[model samples]
Target chain A: MAPSDERHRARMARKQEVVAAKVARASRDKGLLLVLTGIGKGKSSSAFGMIARALGHGMKVGVVQFIKGAFSTGEEAFFRRFPEEVDYRVMGEGFTWVTQDRQRDRQAAEAAWETARAMLQNPELGLVVLDELNIVLKHGYLPLERVLADLSRRTAGQHVVVTGRGARPELIELADTVSEVANVKHAFAQGIRAQKGIEF
Target chain B: MAPSDERHRARMARKQEVVAAKVARASRDKGLLLVLTGIGKGKSSSAFGMIARALGHGMKVGVVQFIKGAFSTGEEAFFRRFPEEVDYRVMGEGFTWVTQDRQRDRQAAEAAWETARAMLQNPELGLVVLDELNIVLKHGYLPLERVLADLSRRTAGQHVVVTGRGARPELIELADTVSEVANVKHAFAQGIRAQKGIEF
Candidate 1:
């Protein structure tokens, strides 16, 4: 039957009622712990997008990059345009594969974690983005327990977003929202270079 | 074993060589057809992030929103700040559940697609974001064949991003890159409201 049919209209009416009830019941307000993971793109990009959203809503934001930063990215240049609203830091020496020294990678991650911990404790920062921190935790550069403790100790209304592949199960368990970005297809696999303004 | 060990050093050397060769092979550059879908948050958020990136790289962007115009979103507000750099449109009556009118939705989606088609043909637009287009396609609000035809007819150097849940198989096949954002846990499930700046 067409959507204009009585049966379809009736079904939709019933569905709407149920949905409205559910929406009405969701009344609580609290800080969100979000994990963006899986071996695909958009993990960090989404977090940065949230930073833009928070800023639009008059929220101060902080960012600490843990395992990127070999080269400057488009986000760094753009967000830097709003220095007063965005506290952006690119602390990673580079990826572990590029650094090739566990000790150096550990030092970079530890320093990045110090900044992240401080941001987590800050109530004034409406949102804190720990970009690529998952890779640091996966490589054991920082203690997962310590990271989790710091996340838990955050101010009640300060949102936190952690992004990268290979998210820890413990972190996922504690997160209020978890999104796994699955790589269905990739341009790189098709011999297309990761171009500027798209991949970054 | 420590990364400074001979074996680890040798392994890193071999891996780096292979990665460098792969990077060298990816010499071709072309327009990208990206699909961001699946039932989770950040699909539109990531697309907005790419919009930011394109703007940062001095690229003019066009955005056509198909099914999300009931309320004002943070992305729309932020991007509006850069009106000269962005062409943003919101052409939806609302979600199907909210509007409860099929004829109106079809008219709105068709109108939105007309704008999207023009953007695809315009080579000057470096990036075009079809926000929530997948949902429109899924709902059969617009003709699938016409949509695909317009996509394939896009300018050689223009990038296009389509975001929403339940991507069509034909669209996915045409997409150079496809990401499925899986919802593992959502705060709404725990009675937490989808707050402003984060969920919008």
Candidate 2:
């Protein structure tokens, strides 16, 4: 082996020892609550990715769309193909900025939350995704405390993913994993329209 | 209608007008270079989500794994099922931290880049995902300028997604969309092992 390779090997051997120690210590097994939030895109997309992951493991998944019912999305179209494994629902009338009616939006959010609560209670589900739930909570369409209460009461070993911009502090605190997607640059900001498959 | 409903209608009507005008003005149609980076999870997951999106549209996709050859991933297993649609290759020997041999790692990255370059040249591919390319770039296994040059030469309507932490500044500047996934809380930080299907 080259001298550089020998040096690298020695360095990695030490690093592996440390990583192995940490890995050995990490033995917990339980359901995780993951939050994907912030102004950048890919929040709901990542949640759908987890749904895919869960499904790949031959586990059932439930998906509830809280605020993107105005149009059909690529994820919904694709995941819905697995009707037996995926309980998918587009429960929102539309985004608040689009629907505009506060009462209507609140009612829709409540209905969506009811469906989400049902999924959380279902022990058969391995993963439950509440897509854009943060936006509903942000708009105060559903009480944050009530949402938190329901989330906290989810069945054991049932992972849940809540995604959207402006995630509440309580949700963030309760989540096992929280990822904030920061926007460095966006096509829309550069006068590019949202494409069919990409944006949806 | 209620008085509040009337006010909401007026507000949304105005908002719609503004949104429609903006949408109409933003008419550019071209392939996008998206970079997902930072010290958080879901970068590659989000890219896989896009692969799902592209597949939903009956579009062809290519996926190249640069630094995750140590084990099989849920994404590889899932996407590879549709062999007709996805051209998947796990080109890396493993992560640099794991493989340790800098020379070997550099050879693997170069080989991966050659495969990636071929895919980028193919106009029929609607989306191409370079999984963990940023990590390869970060370790100096591949020249950033060469990668950038090849990326610039991609077909007009072929979208590309490059994911991993420590994305180079030059690549970030060239990307049409850039998202930095910020780590707020992680399960591993709390001594929880990476679960199969979720972390693979």
Candidate 3:
């Protein structure tokens, strides 16, 4: 082998030792509360990807949409095909700006939370995705304390993914994994309308 | 209706007019180049979700994984099930740290790019995903200029999603949409091992 190959091998061997040690040290196994939030897109999309991952492992999943029931999404259409594996519910009336009724929106959020609470309590569900829950929380439709309390009651091995823009500080504090999708540039800003199969 | 309801209706009417004008003015329809990057999770996962969306529309997709060919991913398993609609290729030997051979890694990246180039030229494919391509570019395994030139040659109306950390500045500039997944918190930091359904 060349001298460069030898040097590369040595460097990798040292890195592997570190990585292996870290992997070995990480032994805890429990359910995680994951938060996907920010101004950028792909929050709910990421949560839906987790749904697919859970389904791949033959684990049941539950999805509750908090503020996107105005129109159908490709994810909802696809996941709904597997009724046995996915307990999907689109409980929101629409976007707050579109609905424009705070009282009605709050009622819708409460109804969605009720379903989410039941899913959180269920041990059989490997993952529960609260799609756009942050928007409702941001609008003050639901009390943060109540939401966090319900989340805390989840089974030990049941994961939850909350997604949307403007996630509360309290939710972030309780989450094991939190990813904020930052928008660098959007197509809409470029005068491109939302397209089917791409955005819905 | 209650007085609050009347006020809500008036507010909605005004908002609708503004939204409608914005929607009406946005009419551009063309293929988009989307980049998902940052030192955070869900970059590849979001791309997979888009694959699902494309499949839902009965559109063909092509996927070339540049640096994650060693382990089996849930996305690979799920997307492979639809061989008729997806042309999926895992071209890399493994992660750079694991492979530890610059020459071999470069060869793999070049081979993957060859496949990706063909897919990009195919107008029938509505979407193409270059998973972990950012890593290959970051390492200079493949010439950035060559990759960009090939991308520019893609057929019109064929969307592409390039995902991984450390996306190049040039790629971001060329992209129609770009999202940076910010790492607010990670389960690995808490000594939590990557679980089958959650991480993989």
Per-model TM-score on C-alpha atoms: 0.96, 0.95, 0.94
True contacts recovered per prediction: 0.55, 0.55, 0.56
Segments in model 2 whose C-alpha atoms lie over 4 Å from true places: A1-3, B1-14
Docking class of 1: medium
lDDT of 3 by residue, A1-200 (tens): 89987898889878878887988888898799999999987777778778777787778999998877445777777777789989999899987768878789989989999999999989899999998999899889999899999999888799899999999999999999999999999898889987655676
Tens digits of lDDT, candidate 3, B44-150: 87887787777767789899988774457777776677799899898889877788788898898899999999999998899999999999999898999999998
Instruction: Give one digit per residue, the lDDT tens place, for model 1 in B7-101.
Output: 65576678888888988888889889999999977788888888878877888999998877556888888888998989989888787877776
Considering TM-score, where higher is better, how would the candidates rank from best to worst?
1, 2, 3
* Per-residue lDDT of candidate 1, residues A1-200 (tens digit): 47455565676678889988998999999899999999877888888788878888888999998867545688888888998988989999886667777778888988999999888888889999999999999988899999999999998799999999999999999999999999999998889988777887
* TM-score of structure candidate 2: 0.95
Worst 10 residues of 2 chain A by lDDT: A68-77
Candidate 2 C-alpha error for residue A120, in Å: 0.9
List pairs with backbone clashes in candidate 3.
Answer: none
The native-contact fraction of candidate 3 is 0.56
Q: Evaluated on chain B only, what are the TM-scores of all the candidate structures, in order?
A: 0.94, 0.95, 0.94
Candidate 3, superposed: residue stretches over 4 Å from native = A1-6, B1-15
